[model samples]
Target chain A: MFKDAWLVASKDLRIERRSRVLTNQLLPFTLVILIIFAFTFDTHPNLLVTLSPGLFWVASLFAMTIALQRSFSLEAENQARDGLLLYGLESAGIFLGKVVAIVIQSAIVELFIGFGIVILYAAPLHEVVFLALSAFTATIGISCVGVVFGAMVTGRSRDSLLPLLIFPVVAPVLLSATKAWEDYVRGKVSLGDPWLGLLVVFAIAFGAVGVLTFGSILEE
Target chain B: MKSDRAVQGLGLVAVLAIVATYILGLWITPPAAVMGNLVRLLYIHPPVAWVAYLAYGVTSVASILYLWKRTRDPRWDLIAASSAEIGVVFTALTLLTGSIWGRPTWGVWWTWDARLTTTALLFLLYVGYLALRRATPDVTQRSKRSAVAALIAFIDVPIVHQSVVWWKTLHQSATVFNASLSPKVHGEMAWTLLLGFIAFSLAYVWMLIRRYQIAVLISKRQEILLQGALDERMSTV
Candidate 1:
């Protein structure tokens, strides 16, 4: 399963590298969101600093949607889905592969947004270890659930439906991640543990769910 | 058809029970020490919220049945879909009635109170679940995807409640609805509340059975239509 997952992940990454969509399109899109947010907040460094944790997650969440859509759309073209299925790849592998690819893309965007927040919002960089851990666990949770819903909504004409379906369900992740980031950035290490624990639990629960259920979704 | 008759009978009983509860709650029950006549809304509000939770619970269980390999059945999918539709309606009612209850008591139509926030999120999640059902055109595919989605969405209910409770405690604001959780109501108020639960449960059964039958009929109609289309194409060839 791990080997199959790596193969699929590498294939997706190779396709992404060749197309440069993530770098050229999505990264700039995320930066544009950060800029828009800065402008919306009137670029008051103090206010921006206060709201930066939420803004960071909001940007990552939006970018996560686009990343999920791109990953699935890669298969939607040229009957590639049938190719994947006919090749006798395990659905778990396909699911993990897609999830890994999304995690990587989302993590990069998240890191770039982190830097953007530091520069644009003047957020302190003291809690580097906590921030990275929060982002890592949150990204895994988002990608696990996101890929399932992404595939669920594939071939549908209603473009906004995926976000609608995913956002409310993922509210806890947003809530916990934001709270943890806020506590960490405020230099209160103890206050961050519960939120961080919530993130880890979410990631593990959904990860198992995705693996068990992906084969059923693929068969359908 | 027999069950349809039974459902109609149950519907009549539900209406009567609801009417009784309303009358007793509004006129027979004395004003409370704190809330006064505004407590009347309590009967309908809690009952409606109960049905909403009950409906979603049914959906979740039915979804599990649909997904399990040994127990997969089309009826389970229909039950899940029907329960969800009813669940959404009741959830909307829960929000509206909750707001009405809040207005006089809390001096605001809405607040970020734990119960209210959690219930609102629950409504949106299931609304998404229903929308998902509409998006998938294939029956088998729709069943599989929605069942899984239903289970995922159900996981949020407890978490949302717990998180909101924690959030509320951290902020230390007085909760709007926690008073009702105490088993303190006595006399007519307590009886009426019990009647309210019974009435709503009956109503849920009636609506569920009716909706499930409608779903079965719709699927049958779709099958016949497909058969007719295939027959026409074959004749043309």
Candidate 2:
């Protein structure tokens, strides 16, 4: 079942590779958002330290929302959602595949944004390890909730409302992850301690809930 | 007739309880040493929040039941939808009163503290739930879709509650359950909160039942009208 799910997910990736929609179009928009932010804010070290985490995470989340919403569209538009259902693959497996694709897409966007921040705002390289860990956990937390929500609310108007609804419940993950990153960059080791625990708890809890609930949600 | 009587009785009980809570909270409850009359705001605020959480809980349970039974029962969806709106109201009230209370206590109308921020987010989530309902046209599909949202949304309830403890924020520590309050309960304030809690729960039950009835009647009428249209088309053909 898991292997079949991986095949279904790879099909999505292969399609994206052929089309290059995410690469040619979405990547540029992400770069544009990051560049716009960098020039708009002050370049002072203290101010950059304060703004960096929020800028990176918010930009990455927005970019990922656009990506995930589009990821399911080809299937949904062609009634492939029905076909996927007919394939008898576990809904959780389907969800995990989409989530994996989303995390990778988001990680790419984060790397671009991180590079932009370092270039424009002069972020130190030492904190890249902590930033990577924070980004990895936060991406999983965000994608876990987003995939289910995107599937559930697919055909509704005001589709933009998906992120608004999700960002709040999943906020602690973002808050802790970003805070930890900021603390690491600022060399505040003490404050970063509990934030690691917070991120882990969010990822585990929401991932479990999202996976358990995905099957019920996938039923028409 | 029995259900009607239940609704009427619950309505009266809700009214009486609200009046009792108001009287005790406004006049009988002593002013706080630090916040003076602002402390009274606590009575109205927390119960509204508690009831909001209660409403969301019911919505979640009802949603899962609707999906599990494959009933698409109008009553279940109606209950889920109604409580979501009511939950939004109570959550809004909580945010408003908390802000009003904050101005004097925290010296800011809004601060990005854990509780206040998370409560604000809960408010956003349900507002989106309400909006999603309005957008979808089909009854079964709407219920199904909203049920998914409701279940996903319930996950946030615990997170919202514990956000303050999880992060350093301007919101104060929970006083009632924590060590901050004395072992002896302050009788008048406690009584006021209890009354308010009871009244709010009664109000939710009364309001939900009323909303459910209306939704069932409307949908039934629509179904009948749709069937008639189909019949007319067939006869003409």
Candidate 3:
């Protein structure tokens, strides 16, 4: 299972590297979103700093949507999904592999976005460890969910249905990550806060759910 | 025909009971010591919200049954879809009535309070469920996709609610209904409130039955149309 998962993940990442889609298109798209938020709130530096965490995640979600579309279309556009199924990989492994690929891509993009937030919005980053930890777990939950729904909406209304289906289901991530990061930036980190626990729960719950159901969706 | 009669019967009783509850709620029962007339909505809002939760519960259970190979049935899919449709309507009413109740009470038409935010997300999640079903035109694929979607939404809702509740309690307002009106036990208000629950439950049952029947009819129509199209193609060949 682990071998199969690695095989799939490496295949996806290799495709991403070969095509340069993530860097060439998605990164600039995210940068534009960050700049747009700065333009939206042009007044107080303090307010912009406070709102930075939320604006950053919001932009991430939009970017995540396009990236997800690209991720699934990598399969659907060329019958790659059919080939993968015929390769006898376990569906759970496929799910995990897709999640890993998206997570890695998102992580790199987010690091850049984080810097963009701090620099452009003049946001403070006092609690680096806390912020990084929350973001790691939160991105796992987001990617786990994104991969699941990304596969589900592979066919019909492929453009619009993906985001509408995903954004609502992963809303807890948005709320917790934003609050935890907001607190972290203000140096309000604490031991065993509920937000971190919530993020982990979301990650595991969706991880299990995606594994159990992805086979059915893939067969469909 | 008999089931149709039964649904009509259930709907009539629901309407009559709701009318009685409203009459008792609006005039028969004395107004509360604090909220006065605003308290009457307590009978309306909670019951509608309760039905919303109940409808989603039914949807989740039906989806689970459909997903499980041992219990999979097309009828379960229909039930899941119908209950979700009803759940969306009740969720909408719940938010509307809650907003109406909150405006005069909370000094704002809307607030980012825990329950309100959670319920709003619930509305969006189910609306997405319905949208997902609409996107998938295939029958079996639709069933599988929506069943998974429904269960995922169910699992996420409590986590969403808990996160919001903790966020509010830790820093923001602890609870939205801190000045909540408790139902007086063994009084006319309590009975009317209880009646509100019964009326809405009955209404939900009636709606579910009607929605399920409509779904059955539509499926039958689709099958006939598909057969007709296939026959024409074959005859041409």
Strongest candidate by TM-score: 1
Tens-digit lDDT track of model 1 for B92-146 = 9988997888888878898876667777888999999999989889899999888
Per-model B-chain TM-score: 0.91, 0.91, 0.90
TM-score winner, 2 or 3: 3
* Collision pairs in model 2: none
lDDT for residue B5 in candidate 2, whole number 0-100? 92
When sorted by TM-score, best at the front, the candidate numbers are 1, 3, 2
State the local distance difference test value for candidate 3.
0.85
Give the Cα error of residue B112 in candidate 2, in Å. 2.0
Query: What's the distance in Å from true for residue A196, model 3?
Result: 2.7
Candidate achieving higher DockQ, 1 or 3: 1
The clash tally of candidate 2 reads 0
Tens digit of per-residue lDDT, candidate 2, span A1-220? 5775687779877887789878897888878887787677766646765788888888888888787777777667778877887888888888888888888778887888888778876767465677688779878888888887777676645357677766766776778878887777777665247787788777887788777877877776
Q: Could you tell which candidate, 2 or 3, scores higher by lDDT?
A: 3
Tens digit per residue, CA lDDT, model 3, B1-237: 887787789999999999998999999988788888888997898788778888999999999999899999999999999999999999999889978888887777787766677778889889999999999999998999999889877864554345544655221231222225444444787788889999999999999988999999999999999999999999999
Alpha-carbon runs more than 4 Å astray in model 3? A189-193, B156-186
Q: Candidate 1: what lDDT?
A: 0.86
lDDT of 1 by residue, A1-220 (tens): 8888998899998998899999999999999999999889965648888999999999999999998888888888897876888999999999999999999989899999999999987888677988999989999998998988887886755367888888987887899999999889888886239999999999998899889888878877
Give the lowest summed-lDDT range of ten residues in model 3 chain B: B169-178
- Model 3, position A142, has a per-residue lDDT of 94
Which candidate has the highest lDDT of all? Answer: 1
Ranking by lDDT: 1, 3, 2
